[model samples]
Target chain A: MKALCWHGKNDIRYDTVPDPEIEHGRDAIIKVSSCAICGSDMHLYDHFIPTMEKGDVVGHEFMGEVMEVGAENKELKVGDRIVVPFTITCGECEQCRRGNFSVCERSNRNKSLADKMFGHAGAGLFGYSHLTGGYAGGQAEYVRVPFADKTHVKVPEGLTDEQVLFLGDIFPTGWQAAAQCDIQPTDTVAIWGAGPVGQFCIRSAVLLGARQVICIDNVPERLSMAEAGGAITINFDSESVLERLQELTHGKGPEKCIDAVGLEAHATRSLDSVYDRVKQAVMLESDRAHVLREMIYVCRPAGVLSIPGVYGGLVDKIPMGALMNKGLTVRTGQTHVKRWTDDLMNRIQEGQIDPSFVITHTVGLDQGPEMYKTFREKQDGCVKVVLKP
Target chain B: MSYSGKTSSSMSQSLGTSDKLARGIGWFSVGMGLFELFAPRTLTHALGMEGKETLVRACGMRQIISGIGALSDNPTPAIWSRVGGDALDIAALTPGLRDENPQKHNVELAMTFVAVTCAADLYCAQALHKRHKYPSSMVYDYSDRSGFYRLVADMHGAASDFEVPANMRAYPPMWAEFTPEKESGLL
Candidate 1:
């Protein structure tokens, strides 16, 4: 099988690897049809998340037909098309019962290793890193899906791969981000980062009935996409996010804020961003918290801060005083993908939203290495890249 | 299944030729700086400029800073700095090339190496700049991509049917008085 393998920092390779086989009764083998390079995958590509080994297959957002199924897995059979959620869950755990699927207690096989790092292991994630169980990802011709019976979302016949593929990750992720805001009809939602997840966040906020939506990003292409999705766009490069947000919300900060940009927030235009870059370069900080600082400083008092961004390891200089005094509520976690996929899939089928709008580039899986660089650099108007495996 | 006729050998790498060159120069800069810092007397004696060890050490520090910058995620600025340092190196070496200096040939050789490295730095810097250049027209119009089947205006609040899960709700029961349903008398 040919897969995109992580070689090192900023190095992904199109390599030939052995075929995946079912390792458990709940496991299934999928012949992947489509996969995407997620923004969080950039963390691994940049070598930020620790525990990634050489030659690890690198992708999670994928959908395909089941080519083989385990005997005890009655939920699916051969020829059943499904989108594999990034977070592997056991469905029987207490967290899964409470709809907190991302933290399902039994999914992570390397729980003790993760316990040493995160205090408690959350869930086993596909291709994220060893801290998340180190399972091989779906950016290949085929993949072995552990706990496949409960970890899959069945795709209907009518939808295209591009329309349904994101159900496994970003679509549900963005939906979860907006849902966490508990958006009221009178609320104003301000989102940072107009990347793919950020784009979906803009649309999700609009769909869920926020009175106004504002998106902040430095990339013009992304800002344009955000505007199309009904967000008032702010280019942090040319104008002030804080000042414009203040003016748009009539001087009272926005009622809800979302940080879609996570660890590698672009280091530009602000003194804090420069400070983050210096700290990151010196290895003093593991994750950049520029967006977090900006969101906390500008959010309305007692407002909700929903974060869907991926942050690894320790972050320095968070404004704890402001966060405490303002009485803000912070909601953050990996998306419990199953909790929202059914609703989002219905929306897709009902002609409410099309996930394909965010895909700006598509190519063969062999071009995965090049596309990683293009997507990371945001070059050639590349907003998102989908690989046909 | 064979997805592509092209094999791994034919695939394009994330690090292009110029990027690899910049990395090479960055390491070379570090190596050169270390030599000048720890063994400045060796360079000074070779060039017949025995009393200039301190100046060599200072130049070494500059090289190290520039090298670290060159090795960073965006190497264009650091590469440009190296070009500037090359000019300084040529100026500093010119004094050692005087007719009275016994090791003027070694100084000339060092100047030649610096000139070659300076050219490489300039080329790499320009390539990186061009690679990272933003599009001249700031915005690429994606206004048509509303992601909705109907007009975006018509799609606003389309998913009002969605109930925020109990654990995720922002406001308490007392705050329901301010809800849109209550405001519109629908409650």
Candidate 2:
């Protein structure tokens, strides 16, 4: 099977690897039809998140048909099409029973190592790093899905791959980000970053009834897309994010804030961004918290801050004083993808939203390497890239 | 597990020609900067300008800064800085090409090397600029991609039928009664 493998920092290769086989009774082999390059995958491509090894298959957003199933896996049989959620859950754990699938205690095979790093091991993630179980990803012709019976979302026959592919990751992630805010009908939601997840956050906030949705980004095409999604766009490169958010909310900061841009915030816009770059270059900080700082400083008192961004390791200079004094509530975690898939899938079926709107590039698996570069650089108006395996 | 250690197919690399060139230039800049910084007297003597050790060291510092910049995620500015540094290098060497200099041939050889490096730097800079910089005139219009089937105004708050999970709620239902309209007696 041909797969995209991570070689080193900024190095992804199209290489031939052996096909996967079922390893457990709940495991199944999926012949992948479509996969995507996610923004969080950029963290691995840039070598930010640790524990990635050479030749590791590098993708998590994929959907396909079951080619083989384990003997005891009664929930699925051959030819059942499904989208594999990025987070692998056992569905019988304490967290899973409580609807916190992202933190299912039994899924991570490397629980000891993760425990050492994160204090408690969360769910095992596909194609993310060893800290998340180091399972092989779905960016190939085939993949081995552990706990497949409970980790997959069955897609109906009418939907195209583009319309349903994101159910595995970004669609549910954006939905979860908005839902975590508990947005009210009269609330104003301000989102940072207009990439794929950010775009979905705008649409989700709008559909859930926020009176105003404002998206902040420096990319012109992304800003335009945000506008199309009913968000008032702010180019942080031109205008002030704080000033504009205040003005848009009539001098009272937004009631909800979302940071969709994670560790690799662009370092050219503000003094804090420059400071973060210097700290990162000097090995003093592991993640840039500029968006986090800006959000803490500008959010209205007692507002909710929902973060869906993938932040790995440490961040310095967070405004703890402001966050405490303002009585803000912060909610952040990996998306419990299964929890929102049923609702989002219904929305897709009912003609409420189409996930394909974010895809701007599609190509063969051979072009996956170059597409990673194009997507990471945000060149050629590349927003989301889908690879047909 | 049917996985094998051997790969049966050829590998496709992520780095392109221009990317490789930029990386090579970055390493070259770093190496040259270190050499000049550590052995400025050697450089000044080789160029027949024996008293300019401090100036040579300053140029080395400039080279190192540009080199680090070139090695960063965005190398366009760093490569351009290299081009500027190349001009300064040529200007500094011109005085060493005087008729009275004993090492005029070495000075000429040094100038030739700098000129070649300058050309390479210019090419890499332009290529990186073209590859990374978004064209100001080419604006992509994605305004039609609302993802909603109906108009946004019609679809706003359509998901009100769904309830926010209890644990994720920001505040209790009683807080919802304190709306600005209600506080102002409009409701």
Candidate 3:
């Protein structure tokens, strides 16, 4: 099997690796039909996440046909088509019972490592690093789906792979981010980042009845996609996000704000973003949380701040005073992928949104190495890249 | 059967090589601690650092503390404590390295052994420290209490009203009509 492996910083190789086999009674082997390069995967590619061994297979957003199943699995058969959630969970855990599958108490096999660091371990994630249980990802021809009966959702017959593939991570992540705002029909939502998750956030905010969606980004293509999702775009390079958002919201600022750009946010206009970049480079800080700070400042008093962005480590100089003084409510996490899959699937099935609209490029598995670089650099207007394995 | 629902054991059962090595060193500390605590004269004499039984006993107490700490829920601090103890051992054994007594060669051998252990201790200590500081790559970092667990507890409780709209029935332009390419032929 050929899969993308992380060799080191800035080094990704789509090379031949061992084929996956079902290793547990609740496991199943899936022949991946489609896989995607995600924004979070960029963290792994650039050595932003730790614990990636040289040959660890990479990729978490994928959907496929079941090739084999463990005997104890009751929900799925060998011939079923399914979308595997990025965060593996056991439906029986207390966390899973409360609909927080991303923090499933039982999934992380490397719980001790996580427990030592986090005081408790969360769920195991496919193709993520050892911090999430070191499970092999689905970037190859086949992958072992742990707790298959519990972690995978059966794709209905009518859907194309592209319509359902993102059910694994980003779509649900974007939806969860927007939904966390408790958007009212009259509320205005402001989002940072125009990447795929940000794009989905725009569409989701509209779906959830936001009166207006404001998207902030410097990328032309991503901003255009947000526009297609019925959002008003603010190019951070050309105009001030603070000024424009304040103007559009009648000086109250957006009632709902989403930070879709996680840790690697670049600042075109803000001097603080440049400082974040410099501090990140020198290891003075582990994450560049410029967008978070800006969102905290730009959001209205008592407004909801929802973060779909991925951030790791300690952030220096967070605007705690602003957050507290304004009575802001902040919500964020790894997407509880399973919690929203059913609703989003219904939306996709109903033509409410075509998730495929974000696909900027498509290629075979061999091009994965180059595509990773292309997606990371935002080259050729690449917002999202899908691979047919 | 299912890797999902089972609670992972804390005794380094399925941990990787590095964790296993750290546990191994931890057990070695316990053994050495017992030896020094129970037989300080015999243990100190063997290392060619004899005649200061009180210092040897104190070192044993430190080793026992560090060993217990290493095997605890968080081994990073304990591992570093072992590292500090190694530094002290090196400093204490320096005289043995130069003594003209017949046992000087024994001290040299012990120094070499301790040097190797120090390197291992440093490597494991740094690795554990990195893991402690940054659990994920820099992108998914959170403080000790700020990661997924607290985030879920704090935020999910607030968004409990979220649900798929009751009237959002499946409408037109079903999934079958969706296609990535412009040909519109796949459907």
Instruction: Give all candidate RMSDs, comma-separated.
Output: 3.8, 5.1, 15.8
Residue A71 of model 2 has an lDDT of: 87
Off by over 4 Å in 3: B1-187
Query: What does the lDDT read for residue A222 in candidate 3?
Result: 74
What is the C-alpha DockQ of each candidate? 0.45, 0.38, 0.01
Worst 10 residues of 3 chain A by lDDT: A373-382
Query: What proportion of the true contacts does each candidate reproduce?
Result: 0.67, 0.64, 0.00
- Model 1 segments more than 4 A misplaced: B1-11, B37-39, B53-55, B80-84, B115-139, B171-187
Write model 3 residue lDDT over B68-143, tens digit each, in one string. 7776545778888888899998888888766565678888888788899999999998876543232222131111
lDDT of 2 by residue, A323-369 (tens): 99988999999999999999999999999998899989787777788
A10-105: candidate 3 lDDT, tens digit per residue: 567767888987788899999999999999999887677877898899999998999899988988898899999999988999999988999999
At residue A277, candidate 3 shows an lDDT of 76
Which docking category, incorrect, acceptable, medium or high, applies to candidate 2?
Answer: acceptable
The digit string of per-residue lDDT tens for model 1 on A1-389 reads 99999988887888899999988999999999999999999999899999999999989999999999988899999999999999999999999999999999999988999999999999999988888998999899999999999999999888899899999899899999999899988889999999999999999999999999999998887888899999999988889888999999999999899999999999487888898888988899999999999999999988889999999988989999989888888999999999998889999999999999998878888888877877888876778889987
